[model samples]
Target: MIVLKAEVFNDGRHTGENIAAKLETMLSSWGIPKENVLCIVRDGGTKMKKGISLLIIKNIDCLSHQIQEKFENEEDPLLWWKVNSNKYGILSPVAKEYLVTPPTSVLSERVFSGAKIFYIPHRNRLHGERASKLLFLKFNIPSLQFNY
Candidate 1:
């Protein structure tokens, strides 16, 4: 998880088209080829859904909060994926990409998300970086204004 970009949303219009345009500009600046986007996890806002659809990538409901609950009561998901990656074959890589996804984006957006699941044993060896920092990066999303 890393903070790649940050900017103010001076224009308070959170329309889907406007959001998509802003997203495209950011993606362009980051040199992220549009086609590489496997999926997007978004909140239950109409504009959010529309904007994600505009990107033409798979969109998933924001399930990070639920992930915390699951972790508290069950097994680690990343570890599960690592163990089952071979069994799933092609889907394994897809799971990896989605596992790192953030829930949403705002002014201080996180380019890469899903770091909240980093509480596993391996997190302590993350080059001396703090777990809180990783969680912050995971929650960072590109800036946009919308009703939630």
Candidate 2:
């Protein structure tokens, strides 16, 4: 659920190559080595798939993605993966990690929703830097106060 980037883009078209380049730049800026990025979890959109593929990282399907097709048992995929982790030998840990993939982009959506609360019509004149700082504090203050 970590949010590495929350930028507003005005690009007319978002192509796979452009997305991949941006992702690479973002990862490098964060000091996250390419090898450390094990997998990317995204929807089945062609653009998303192509972008992730260009990154040279494994791309996995969003477990809880909604589609017209339905499975017989509607069990939680993470739970199922955990229960069967033992069955996978050398890849067991990878399996568990994959299971941790967020079923949806709800966390990012929530952050956007929270940001909207701060940027009300009356307060829309706030400077971009001020707004960013306020949003950062609003989201991270709780973690900062932890005893650990």
Candidate 3:
């Protein structure tokens, strides 16, 4: 899994159009061309669905939201997609893109802890893109394996 980038989103209005615009801007900034994006994996909120038309991308319902009660199957999605990507043609890359995204299971307290670690009261310049990368690395590195 990869975090790619983790920039702050301090938009005043959280409308679907605004969200889509920010997403496009972020994607462009990250050097990800629009053609590479198959669809966006987001919750089934009305606003999220609304962004589909504006974002010019299909919306893939987040699996966490899809299987809310419990995950009975123990299959890894990345492995499954990797093995079957060729079978679906264009969909293969699309599914793989979504599967590589790091999952969000952090609790509220841990998030506050990350905030504390990144931004102390006196040294409050740690925000925007720099802080985003640090926080992403801190949370995701533990899940990665080393082969040394």
Candidate 4:
């Protein structure tokens, strides 16, 4: 397994030298050479411990993850077409006028917050299901189909 050590001190709270010492101790015990490990130092005038300066090591990147990342980086017209589609639950006329965007985050926040509130008995028996459908309709505001 390839080990990566990075200096994660933003406000001089930590140091790269301190990190290397810890890595050296850990790697030494595992019978791994010091050259095998990699250390990334933070930029700017920050004081680290002592000897931990710069250690560079090469590691193989996962092919699957790399391909997935590449795909994510590339722009696909089909995706944009779907994103602009009314069925994708993004763009809406009523939503555009009033609501800025879909309330996904608000709903998530509400889920946690709502759990604390009193168990208010719903008015309708199928209110939960109806509400979900209404939410879908609200976000995916229907566009007139041009049946040519």
lDDT of 1 at 90: 52
Q: Is candidate 1 or candidate 3 better by lDDT?
A: 3
- Using TM-score as the measure, the top candidate is 2
True lDDT of residue 74, candidate 3: 92
- TM-score-best of 1 and 3: 1
How many residue pairs clash in model 2? Answer: 0
* Model 3 misplacement above 4 A: 7-11, 67-148
Backbone clash pairs for candidate 2 read none
lDDT of 2 at 84: 59
lDDT tens string, model 3, 1-148? 3566665557666677876777787788889876667554565676756665687775565655543432237988767767665554456677777667456655656867896787888878766789878888888777886433
Which of 1 and 2 is ahead in lDDT? 2
**Taking the tens digit of each residue's C-alpha lDDT, what string does model 1 give over 10-74?**
79888988877777787789998877764444456788678768987555555552233234337
Report the C-alpha displacement of residue 136, candidate 3, in angstroms: 29
Q: What is the lDDT of candidate 1?
A: 0.63
**Model 1 shows how many backbone clashes?**
8
Tens-place lDDT digits, model 4, residues 104-123: 69875665554433234663
Cα distance off (Å), candidate 1, residue 63: 1.9
The lDDT values for all models are: 0.63, 0.71, 0.68, 0.46
Model 3 earns a TM-score of: 0.40
All candidates: CA RMSD (Å): 15.2, 15.0, 15.6, 17.9
Candidate 4 regions with alpha-carbon error over 4 angstroms = 1-13, 38-53, 59-148
Q: Tell me how candidate 4 scores on lDDT.
A: 0.46
How does each model score on TM-score? 0.41, 0.44, 0.40, 0.24
